[model samples]
Target: MNGSHETEIRELMKSYFDGLYHSSSDILRTVFHPDLAYVNGTTGNYEHLDFEEYMARIDARTPPASRGDVREEIIERIAFKGDRIGIVEARMTMMGRNYQDLLTIINTDDGWRVLTKVFSFVERKA
Candidate 1:
């Protein structure tokens, strides 16, 4: 990928991490597309949530940052199939748990938008 594309994707992922850290709906909405489909099956059941549901969950939760939860995020990789489609893998720390998320991103007329997320989380034992 070109440097500019990489930079743009980095910023978008940064927004995603910041949104999760702060529980900010606006920031989350900016990076994620409205028709986003998020799936997680780590809890033994296949679960899916749309963008609105996800944002609502974020709104309901107390931000990890506010609780003094130490947070770290790393963008593991970004791969592109063409000019429009990209995939990102990242690991993050929040709410005393660790999460790894695979995000599918697309470059639209508006800009780069996260199309979907498939994630897994592990709760840390005290």
Candidate 2:
């Protein structure tokens, strides 16, 4: 399981974006934990909400149909002492925006589940 944690997290991330592309929140259910956190520039304000809060936002809002690449990255990877906890640094290109997201997840009894996902925009220098 130790060797596969990173791969598992990568798959979780892939599913996450794919979920958004299809607006199928069910796919999200497979990736996030009940108490996950999400942050992005779109909020205009920051929110530190749990899973329900996150899901409600997703449920309430509608994303353009596959407007951009999941453009998400696997920049850096680290496995914790328990090997069950992993932190990943990645970037995503969504709707023409470039994002750097920090994903924290745990390999739980069920499988790899994201505990938190925080993202901020990265401006490219001309």
Per-candidate TM equals 0.95, 0.76
Best by lDDT: 1
Q: List CA RMSD, all candidates.
A: 1.1, 3.2
lDDT of 2 by residue, 1-126 (tens): 465766667677788777765666788889888778776644565657778877777776566464544444445555555776877776665555667778788878989888888877755433
**Tens digit of lDDT per residue, candidate 1, span 20-61?**
999999899999999999898578846999989999998998
| Residue range with the least summed lDDT across 10 consecutive positions in model 1 | 38-47
Candidate 1 residues lying further than 4 Å off, grouped into runs, are: none
lDDT per model, in order?
Answer: 0.91, 0.70
lDDT at 76, model 2: 59
> Clash number for every model?
0, 0
Measured with C-alpha atoms, the lDDT of residue 48 in candidate 2 is: 72
The lDDT, on a scale of 0 to 1, for candidate 2 is 0.70
